[model samples]
Target: MSVAMKGLRNHITPVSKIIITSRSKNIATFGTTEALQLDFLPKEAFWYFFKTIAFGSSNPEEEPKLAAVCMEIAVLMNGSFIGAHVIGGILRSNLSGQFWYTFLEYYRYFTGWYIHLQGEHQSDMFKKRSGLTYIWSYKNWSAVTATFHLYQISSANLNDLPVIRTSELLTRDIKLEGKFDALEWRSSVPPYYSYMVHHEYGTGNNHDVITAIESISFTIDRYYRQHQGVEENLRKLHRMLLRIQAIVEEAHGRQITNQAMLLQLRMVRAVMYRGYYFLDNFRYRTVQAHAQDEVGDRSLGLSPFSQFKRFCFSTRTRKIASEVLDQKELQKMLGHLENIVSDMQEFVAFVSCYPRMSRQPYCSYLLLENCMFGRQIEQEKIINFLLEPNHPSAKGINVLPIIGPGRVGKSTLVEHVCHDERVRKYFSMIVLCSADSIGGGFLTDTGLIKHRNPTSTGQSLVIIELADDDMDDRTWTRILHNLRGEHITPVSKIILTSRSDKIRAFGTTEALHLDFLPKEAFWYFFKTIAFGSRNPEEEPKLASICMEIATLVKGSFMATHVIGGILRSNLSAQFWCRFLKCFRHYTDMHISVLGEHPSDAYTKTSGLTYIWTSRNMSVVAATYSLHQASSAQLADLSPILSNDVLTGDVEPPEKFDALEWRSSIPPYYNYISHYEILAQPPDMLPKRKRSRSLSEGLV
Candidate 1:
């Protein structure tokens, strides 16, 4: 292959480009021109591809139910084209909702599809100044080994650099390993809760394990965090936790701790379990909290026997009555949480504040082709300002400020200008600085302006992103001074981006205020993200929905990305309408995509955002209530409250708050209300009342 490529390169005259695709790294390296490795489709792109394949030639809008089923299956396909093709063919053969549901059940156990976690490659580590090298391979899947040396890191940091290795899956009866072992901590090992309790119950019998799983699944539906860690005092908490788990496991054994403290700890443990499971599996049920009173109600039948069993070996009633513990428990629970949170915050602060040597700042310079939708004109304008000669009378370095609100494409436009062929030729060196990198001794600390070559001179273009308004004038003045000092070229220039108008004073040239995308351009960009390559003419109904969605989203690139992501997996009219109904609620509400909320089901680890209602009140109560009831009981109660509960007509009592929100709702009503919130669109409620309904809580 190398010889052939060399021969072809020698024979071909005026060859401008050469493309090569190979499973072997050595063969790919034979290309005389630049060799690039292909990357797996991103989540959004993967979903779009699956959606198209699953519903080819037919509008998913027609089969909302089937589309919904397909959506669930698509998420599991993980970026496997082969799986999509096979699954798509299966779905295409049948359109029945029953068939789809059966397919879902079958696919739940299907293990044909798999996601390749990070892969490792063996290669010699090259020394610094060798620059970057890429080597591709096709073991397991196509992967590229990136080799480079950053002078900023010591030998210790290199050793600490996380090495990717294939990890074993946690399954039935796996022995506990590390304290942070992903599954062990989550308590999702062999002889799962279901297996343990299932044997004791007859047909249609409800088990404590079932309730626990249901509760976990319910919690996941609302505030399902994929992973959460309980803050341990590292000072002998491990032995205590292990002991607690052991006692909890034995149906007849009990560990006597302060009843209130035990409940508090259990609550913490349950949250931790849910968080971990939230991260591991998309559809996993964890049993966090269980009712002591409800234990083995049917298994040993009769209340007296249950009481006898409890009296013989009970964790509660050792220190205090559980009912007494419940009374005024809200305040005590809050106090415990506050203390825990305070300690966690302090630990976070200490970790963050730990001293470390500064390293050279790095940024990706691979200019994305056609990424800047409406930034062409802005790029050209910035180029004119950047390359434009400084005034003859002007002294020191000149600064050009590009200002805009967050996510208004300021960085993108400047990036385009920075990477422009003209600008590349014009500037000898280009330094990109983010807001976080700025502080006292900014350039020196970041290694942006190397002191080793202090005497060297070249026309440099320094790009500064002013992230915060807190940057004082002294820092800005010092930053400008260093750019054009004796160490830098006399003609060096600076360009800055900021959301603050106060930064304009620092700009030697007039500030360039970035304008929001024009309606045509904005919609064009929105369509590109939301629709990808799907043709509007072929899917006019979806196209129209897309147009409406554009208006509902905030006019920002980030907003477009988020809404487009939500739409990518969903193509049916019902899904679109559902999204539209809640569109205002989502946009208006403070949706934290960061997924750091400890109490939210949609956790940072899970990367899945559960659809939440805008109605005021925490969803915790509703989540817990649904968890307490069995599926049959929940099913039976859904019909009675289906109409009023969801309509916002069933109002909470006057003087409702967090405590009342928890204590007031019966489990049946709570689940029904939650389901209503999840299923019903906000469009059903009156505008004035809907606006008024929003309270300061999770729902």
Candidate 2:
């Protein structure tokens, strides 16, 4: 082979090429050029090929039932071109649904028996050149009498042997007393190969075959029940959701003075988000399946057998597959949604009673992205505190403290409340004073009066944002003294925001502590914003990937939007998987080194964070000295965006400014961070220890 290839190469011109193909990798070394390894057709292409050949001159759409059966049969073929041709011919010979079902039952049994006997799928067994063994029972016989060994054969005089068709084995007349060669299938394409199996008589009962058939029937029935009327249920769910959304939108347009009604509205909105998530997830199941299959196919040059081993043995893959295949859970979710909608009839009627508040028209998702999320109750509390009237005997101003960790929407919450039409109408002026502004003499009696609205009540609402919790009552007293010199009334109020619990001492009212969103709520929020207008159901695999990403995000809104935007920009499963991998690596790296996740450090305002850049897939350690800064300071910083750095769009300097994210909504603060790229030490821990550390950190 080497000598022949060398002679052929010599005869070929510079522009001309000699192409060679082989099933074995050893043949590649015989060529002078690099070898090109071909992979199995992607699931979509293979399905199209299989169905086209299986149902020649017939429309699959017209025979939906048979087409469905053909899909299962195709899956059983396991990307084998010869298998497709052989099975396709058998199905094409008999167009009857009963005939197809019978063939499927037999095929399913054969594959299952082979797996049981070989400890691997028949596909993998064949790929390894290992003969497949399975018990065969005839329908007319009360017992199993045949044992088969299926294997591929390549010989010069293949036609000289007695050829027995695989379909003939399904009949009662076929009998084998001893081991004999029986042709299983013959390829009609290039490199036409033949598959033959050896058969021998055996003594066994038919119980095992009957049991396998029973199990298969049960699974098929369950699947049927799960998918039956799924389309109609989804349509009904969509319609009910629209109705519920109409009510929710109407409620949002109104100023509901009733606290109970407001709480009910929140419940309705939560259910709405979940229903939509599941609805899209179910509708796009097929798309997600194809995307996931593609991800598996592009496993960095792994062969079909390697991919099969990974699929069967990878714990994570198996778990995800099990979750994705749980049709019962999906059906249950549908019923739950239907029940919630049915229960909302009265709630929907009462939502219209609240007086309307004038607002700009916007889509729900757009409004969510540009406005506050998962903070409706907190926003209402702040607004109520500002709008409440003070007692006649009350001394000094009424103060309410809002405290939370960094980037917990402390400033954004206050901004949204101050912009409320009701609050604006109630207070004569709303002044926002940061800790720096107060210390720098930005707030004064003259400034207060100057900033106050002319056409309004004499009461002023002052919102003070403290940088930390160390501020004492004296500072609050001084601020009040400066405000009291102006046109402050008994109804005047002070709202203090800080990240420390010590600041709560300055407030006369109970401090409202903000926390990260619960897992379910965050998933809903992340899914909504990350998926944007694209229906998540259409890319279930991507949605699932997003779900994992959301968990890693640790409920940080900044991470959600930043990472979500990256994912949303590229809908490709491969890109999303790459991002997921890099994110997980960095997250695990941070935990292994620092005993905490980067998000945990981010919430605490400063720490070491490991970020992965796609540039050569290197890990960079960025020690954050500052978590945020004013939009004014953004002018002095580098033009590099944090996302651009993470995505490897641009290289980062040793020490430079990177804009984390800028809020589009209230406060409109530009979050900037200062980072120095510290050298990452070589991994010294054993592989087992590193994995253990990652698992512990995740927990």
Candidate 3:
């Protein structure tokens, strides 16, 4: 075919265009010009097309339920025009919603089974232009009488073979005792082709249990020797993690605009974090055990009794180590990491296509600690919204409401977006106003007006930071009115960020909601900060302890830095264990009394919370009524720090100021807390909660 096309192309007139399209890459190479590869249709376009054909003359709006089911079927089609026609024709023949739902259920089952067996969605295979043939063998099901196979074949004589439609296999029960061909699809356009699959039914024997056991025994003997295989697998996983990290770092430095690409990047990041979590947990535990052995050996010298005690301890340690470092588990981890690496082959290739952004020359850890973490998608959305031109038919200024829980980085995201080079270049003047400032008439202030860019007529970007959720509709309207009156340009945009969801209603566009980082992402961020410039593998014991501390910290950005700094300062395992004990006690006590985690209480509500404070070599629980939580410029922060108070280095007065954390990134403000220590009656003292020690299970 390629040779024929090549010869035919040369015979064509100079002005004539010869367009060739094929599913095969080899056939595409025969073209003289660069091949234009087609991707799946955009979701919106596909939905519209699917709706038109599926409903035919019927009104989709009249049957909302059927339309919903049709949408699901359309998604399953994966933008295949052939699939849409076949499935839509089936539904169009019977306009019952129940029938459509039944078809959808069967379709879902077929696709799900394919995904389960092949490790990818059937739709994905369609998108890849892979042949429609898929083989499934029911080896374990006793209900099946014989094995069945599916194949895609092309034949001119359709009447000679027993034909069955793929839909019949899904929608109806058909008994087959012999081989037959299933018609999967038939192209209706030019060069009409038929997609047929051959199904063969036969019996298959199950594996012998004795032989399987022997094989398993051999594998155990080979890989479980002195845990050498486990170590090798760990090394492989570590190398893979490093590769993923390199790609992720490069991606972070680039401006990735494609939504699909961003989603893939996010998946890659998740896999990378999971790999690191497991790797770090295993390596650190091993290192800590070895360190403990060294300490034990030094303490218990060569005396007969000491040697006997050492032997017992070593035996117990080895047992624990064996349980933790199971070779099979290590193999599983390695396999997963390898699979992720394989899947990312294309993602890594395309990551390089994105344009790189100008970044500071700081170390990755430093950058992670100082910059916002795990909100790339949200950041992109904000930037896109800000840079987009106002719709010609739109009225008033554009408002984007960013709503999130307290300390969830809503303000930081806006600050970063405002600082973006594109945003700075697009807006002539950037005005920042707080809820208080708005209420205080800062918009009409003569001093603020005087500082505006008078000569430049470019649009102004107004950023309003609302601290509470109680902003009324009237107030919001007044703010917009005031902006219009002052700026005199409706094109000027406004970004409203608040800790409450109430402000979301005031936005002209969809509100961007911010949430705390997932456990995996937060662990990655915490680990980076906790280890600073040091390699975690070098201080495995500390790394192990840091994971536990991060788990207890409950995704608090302030606690991450504070606790991370404390642990980094003192690398001793003993100190880390002590800190972990204190933290655990703190959280457990709060959970017991308040019925929730202390961090949750701190961030989610403005209520009187019991804070952890130790004194006189014991854990002394102190109650503090949170008066106000506010952000201030670094210079304005109180001298007293929360770390000092928590560590019992300085006992604050009844009512005092304590600095929580100072932001190292844009809009760098010191988060301060004004609280009054509550006096607890002796009779009201909470009972002590007992918990496991770090060394209880392991020697």
Candidate 4:
């Protein structure tokens, strides 16, 4: 640790002084300051504890030691937490999660910190001493707070926690005692708000709790909850600033930066993330309450509300700090905040587009493209597969499962069909919902409770499924549970889409297994996106472009989309000739666009994200160009995927991959979390599991 940090640490630790209680009744079980400290409390024990966890490893034979260390750390943290509870202390820093994570039981696996950054502080010692120690920092305070809140927020359905405002010390069973069951629940929960992004609010107080609850509630109630999740996280951040503003005012009151003021700030920061979870448990069904939603059926005991609260808090924090705050001290904070919001938005939007990716998924995806549907034999085959002749539920008109790999356009096809005017008018209420899978970002707007059943009595309901399939069976089971009505209350039309053939295999009814778009249609879609509105008649060269597209696509929708996006975006007759030449070169290691290299073109242009703003999408859009590739492809295309790609308020790059990207799906790492549906290829699903996560190891 640097001398400054060491000095800071020493000053931050509270030293207990004797404060004899006025009377016995008030003394109670815990003492004043001394009572606040845990057994064998060491002022700087946390730093050592973290260093051991981050830098040390354990052997199986040493399991007891690891367990002991974990328990000790937990004890120390619980003490700190209780200590804060008594005095209502502030957090140690703007970054809040580091402390709370010890008890949350999420990071018992592997987690560490890195700090080799420069802030224009060029001194050699600054790099050496200041950079030697790495920590989780204040960025992930929201996620930590969320994990902690899991115990509280999930108690909503409990016979306990009768009211939102409870001052009495809360006590309940929040432990995950078994070998991996507890961790499994923790694993399934979203860590969208990680330790890297969130900074701290000094005081762990009632206001932040309220803000955290509001954020989580906003996320839970809103469809496409991930976006709201981010928004709430941003709010927590703004609240964090509010805490800082208060602290600065307090310090300014004294007109000094003395030891007293510094200690006060650390104390305030400590408490901010302390009971930060109090509000996380506010809006949703508590773990104690029966989920009554889809997830409730599968993992019955754990709560995801904690992570949800954290995510909501982190998202809100970064947003308002950039959008509204103009404090001079926060000048650079403004820039960083804006970047965080942009990245997070891109991250959120990308995750939502995963569902509804099948050829017949647009209806399920919620895109009403006015498409036409056909294919009888495939549909029948799906029905047969869904309900085998021997299965008990095989007697009636059964629901069939539609299955494919991730990013395959399953949801898109379903969405397209559902949105068809015929289908739209066919069902009294066509509800397209998502079952957001583990580790994925928020995709569709539909939750298990609110969005699934929209049709009234005597009306037909078409239930289009998305991400909810992973951990939810209630929504689907509800379909069966609701079907035995005596009066035929409502005609239920159900379509299920999932990457898991296991889940799809269980669905029985009319099923259509999506394959890649046919060659002719691929050509049409590719040419349409590539050559749009520009007359093939006016530019006779379109014939050659069309032939080139057909050859490259080769009956693959993905290939067509990727090539078409490129061709249409670079639509000048001259650009087409060069584009064709460039395509040939990629096959032959050739470089095409002259006067500017391809890399330079990526740099000089507004970047692909802005291609949507271009009036003439043909020869100038990104979405139209690569219609079938996953957003993961775009994330890989970053640096080139600049800010303009987000809001699309700017002009596109010259020779851009043109196609107005109406789809809100941004690229995300996890395929399942998309709001729409996965349009994965036939063999891709198994391979993803076989392969290592590309982003996890290095990044």
For candidate 2, the per-residue lDDT at 229 reads: 62
Which stretches in model 2 have alpha-carbon errors above 4 Å?
1-215, 218-222, 230-235, 277-290, 296-336, 361-367, 434-451, 473-491, 627-632, 680-699
Overall local distance difference test of candidate 1:
0.42
Q: What is the C-alpha lDDT of each candidate?
A: 0.42, 0.66, 0.64, 0.34
The full ranking of all candidates by lDDT, starting with the best, is 2, 3, 1, 4
lDDT score of residue 143 within candidate 1 = 19
State the local distance difference test value for candidate 2.
Answer: 0.66
Task: List the candidates' TM-scores in order.
Answer: 0.33, 0.62, 0.59, 0.28
Per-residue alpha-carbon lDDT of candidate 4 for residues 1-699, written as tens digits (9 for 90 to 100): 235334544546553443444334444454534443224336456434443332244221222223323443343343242222211211222112333333232221111101012111111211121222111112233211211111222422332322321111111222211111111011114532111111122233222223444644543344334445444654665565454435433332231223333444334333332212212212111221232122222111122445434433343332232222222323344344444444444333333432322233422332212232222223323322322332356433355567765445666555444443334443444444443321122222232221223342333333445453363566555545444343232434455676565565555544455655444344434555456556443443444445553554444433343455555565654445444433332221111112222222221212221112122221121212223335566455332332233223344443333332324321212111111112341342332221112111111
Residue-wise C-alpha lDDT for candidate 3, range 523-639, written one tens digit per residue: 888988887777777776667667778889999887788778777776776666666656655565556545677777557535556555533223333444333333534356455
Local error of candidate 2 at 607, Å?
A: 1.6
lDDT tens digits, residue span 541-638, model 2: 78867776888999888888778888778887888876775676566555655667777765766766665664345665567765556666777665
**Candidate 1: residue 69 lDDT (0-100):** 71
Instruction: Residues 1-37, candidate 1: write the lDDT tens digits.
Output: 6576566665437556667666557765566666777
Off by over 4 Å in 4: 1-397, 420-428, 434-491, 535-540, 553-566, 587-660, 664-699
Error of 1 at 327 (Å): 69
